[model samples]
Target: MGTTQLETVPEPKYWHLRTVLSNALDSEFEVGEILPNERELAARFGVARATLRQALEQLELEGRLQRRRGVGTTVAPPRVGVEVNPTRHSWPGAPGDAWQTEGCAEDVPPAVVGRALGRGDEKVYTVHRVRTVHGQPVATELLYVPPASVPGLSGIAGLETDAGVARGRAVLRELQRLELGGQERTVELGSARAEDAKRLDRLPGAPVLVLTTRYLAAGGTAAVAVSTYRADTCRLTFGESAGTGLLAAG
Candidate 1:
């Protein structure tokens, strides 16, 4: 007869610490209230600084806390409810739109975008935009407008060299001249890429809601939009809503 040893799996200590800290946040902390220093919190929780930091990082990703480089950590307010669905279709820079144009460039889009637009290796107008709510940057968008959609773009003076708010406006005006029939949209979860992370002011690989939209004109793909929203700080609503509550459980 032989004795066999049982295999024991250990749960990650940081995961357990995250739960404890989350409870404290709900019951004991107020929004915008700063917490104790990391060293003090680590001591209070009887965990190593690294473990404490792991938990804190999770909290920040969940939008439960805001960590500033020089300001330390504080409780975060409720996430913003962004209306995504409307009764009608409109251009990106339409009046009262949430996004502000950052710059415009004529470059080749990502492979996925190229496939969507049915253009291979062809350069298009890439309009960079930043969407904000309460003055906080929440999303970044890269809009790829094919040459066929804006035939007059080349005729427009200073379009290639212009890289400002006005540049985006000009492009939008040219796009608006076309008859926009409708658009198709798809949403999925994705990790923030390097460029989007810098614009969103979050660490690379943070969770985000990626939205891909295709604008159709005269039965052809006119433009494509790829928007990455901060998953923790935004609650995407499909239509009109009542109160400001998280649309889904985190």
Candidate 2:
């Protein structure tokens, strides 16, 4: 009789450490509880400091841990849920909007953004916006609008010179003048760009949730907005019922 031999699966050390730490987090650690220093943790787990760090990195990416430069690592609190529903069509600057205008610039967008806007080589108006909750910055947005789409913006004040927050507001106000037919939104995983990282107070190449929205009008694509939310701090919810968890947490 021939016996069948089972193949043994080999698991990476960091992966096994991650599992152990995850269990510890669930059964022992409380939210905001400071974790032991890396050296101690490495020694306790009998692994290299780099391996322990790898486990912590995975936990942080999953929103289970938080690390600050000066402050040590701690168990992260639950992520804040932000809603993005489409029951009604409204411009970004509409009443009760959570974003704040930061600045505006007229320049050729990056190739990816220009491709999405269906305009290559032509200049577009870029507006910078930031969103916060509990005074902590959670997301940074870049809204692109072609000149032909917002013809009346030329008459708006401060667009040519300062391009400050006032100009951003003026551009949005002019954008709302057009009739919005519909909009499309998509979410994907992405790395933080340098400028976006500075805005979100994170290191370059940090994990982020990228949301791309395209606003349509009778003419065609009127605007395109790309919002980068800190994946470690945000849990995006959709629909009216999305507010339930947020309200309870608050």
Candidate 3:
């Protein structure tokens, strides 16, 4: 019996390192599991620290690695899809299901929000949240709702947990009571704020996708939620499937 020697193939330093790390993560890591520090990992890979850091940065943008401050880098999970579907009106939860809520004093809203709400300097409920993916922060969302539009809401009842989805559910529970009429959405380029950048582990002023939508209920404007999702690591899915019409040209 004899053994045959196999040929070895190599690519760019960073590319090979990235592949090695990505495969290791897929096979050996669980969501929220932190990887060894850069210095250690680079030493293990026999590559320069800069090369390893570049690879890690790419993986992080791809939603595979999560970098934290003071803490360390960890494996990031897949991004959750929170759709803005016309078919569904509310989320899964009780009247009070959000992670937490604060009674924001009434104040004048931004110009864009005022137009969406179709009111002038009206008081509204402002809710903010930091959504995490794979235990790493990803995005920040702000929800502004006119108090009069959401009737019978004495307080934010179910928002206390650290879970962002729970908080969204709580808001939906309160929102469902009003008849959902129509809605509008817009997408624009935005720079990350200091707070959001801190959570997302990106430099301040990093590019992001800003989705501003107004929720209309009971033939009147209810609230507007401005959600900022990382453009590099996120995809927005909207509308129905695309199909060729019978009358269309091939």
Best candidate per lDDT, number?
2
**Would you give me the overall lDDT of model 3?**
0.63
* TM-scores for the candidates: 0.75, 0.72, 0.71
lDDT of each: 0.80, 0.81, 0.63
Worst 10 residues of 3 by lDDT: 241-250
In candidate 3, what are the lDDT values of residues 158-185, reduced to their tens digit? 5543235544445556776776676677
lDDT of 1 by residue, 1-250 (tens): 1111212316677777777788787778877788999888877767789987998998887888888667789887667665466456887777756688888888999998999999988998889999875456878999999878988877988777887777777888788889989888888889999989999888999899998889889988999999898988877767546234344324
Cα RMSD for candidates in order: 7.7, 7.5, 7.9
TM-score of 3: 0.71
TM-score of 2: 0.72
For candidate 2, lDDT tens digit of each residue in 59-101? 8878788786677997776676655665566888988678999
Q: How many times do residue backbones clash in model 2?
A: 0
